[model samples]
Target: MANIQWFPGHMAKALRQLRENLKVIDIVFELVDARIPEASRNPELNDAVGTKPTLLILEKSDLADPRATSAWLRYYRQHNQAAIAVDVNDRKLTGDLTKAAREVLKEQRARAAEKGIQSETVRAVVAGIPNVGKSTLLNRLVNKKVAVTGDRPGVTKKQQWLKAGKDLQLLDTPGVLWPKFEDQLVGQKLALTGAIKDSLFAKDDVALYAIKWLRKQDQLTALVDRYHVTTEDLSLSDVDLLLAITQRLGFKDDYERASERLIFDLRKGKLGRLTFELPEDSEATDNA
Candidate 1:
């Protein structure tokens, strides 16, 4: 697998801004892709926000496997972290996010009361990697289009503050990725989920990685059902399987197009609900 690396100048500036503003922010609303929560998390940001209250918002829950999401939520809760799975388009997102913020700030609120100060509003900064739906979540929370949102990464170039409600003020920051990925699988997972720009890596390489990973999860049935391919097709090598899938879809000579389409389908949830990594798998990797 190719080692993917992307740390643009804007990301460096964003990290500096985050560190500078950390002291003023009451909590960090860290948005991560539900499909690859571990890979989507920015370790540099986490270290910068050390000891600050954080609420992990697993955005795009609709695109992830429900069972895997549940397990992750349980895992986070056990580790004493406040995490919630949510889809930005859901009607209840506003209330759910508000409740989560307050829950994370409960002790701070109590301390303020003890000091004869009463403030209902909680100041939070939303930090995450590119294209992890931070802008979408912010827009949904504010119930209007306050942030520039797109399907691709690097949509938000700077920081902007918006009022979410009477008790919540959110600072929407540009997504920042770390300088390097220690795990090659992390890079592959990020690329597979569109958190990283597609132009950084070959579509066919990413498609092959996705194919092999999905096969390991025994989740290739979605691809088979969607493409009308047989189980025998799954037995082929990653590259050959993609070629076969493309041939079946009448793109016999356009394997590149087929690979791109397959990746697009996975990103748009056309293939099915799938998650790239699970807590158990990460835990095992850590142990290894």
Candidate 2:
């Protein structure tokens, strides 16, 4: 969830400030993009918070592939359910999270108890890439709008705090980025989903990334079928593919217009539900 393409000037300073604050935090809520958890994990953050108790929250889980989300939960469970998928707005989440957080913090809390420390309230840092609902999730937990919400990314420019509950506190910071992308497919996926800043990715490249995944996932074909693409031979490189999709969707215009329309439709998920990763998929891959 970390997109820092626009925050170059703030990058160094943010890192400096982040280093100073990491020591004071109790737990790191390392949020990954639910759609691409393997990609969104920030190595810089991982280095900074070295060995700190971390709750790997796969945010925006509702929009991601459910099978992938479930797989990740099992994958990270060796560290006491290190990963979890949650839709922040779900009404039952407050109670569910409280239980989960307590479980994650039990050992640390126990150590504190031995030192004659009563619970000094649970302080957690909610951090992830831009636009993954870090601020929105914080607001929902406390039932208040403590930060700005926007369709655009990188909106929160400063660190803020929200009282998640009587004993739970959320520390909000600007989104962070890893040093570089080790996986190119991850980069493309980010751009295609509007996860990366528009300036950082070429529009056509993003479109192709969308096509790459959408073409293979059956659920994504609803838009393709609507757009009238003759899926006789699905080709990601075919420039006319968008035209077919758009026309099938009933656009009364040239292929260019249809392509543009299809792009919008793809971004908004007119395609059906898809969980990009399944537990079996990961397990099978791991076994291989």
Q: Say which candidate scores most in lDDT.
A: 1
Clashes of each: 0, 12
Off by over 4 Å in 1: none
lDDT of 1 by residue, 9-63 (tens): 9999999999999888899999999999988999999998989999999999999
- Give the true-structure RMSD of model 1: 1.2
The number of the candidate with the highest TM-score is 1
Distance (Å) between predicted and true CA of 66, model 2? 2.1
Candidate 2 lDDT tens digits, 13-105: 656666677777788888777776766767678787777778888887877767767767877785354677888878976666666777888
Deviation from native of the Cα of residue 120 in model 1, angstroms:
0.7
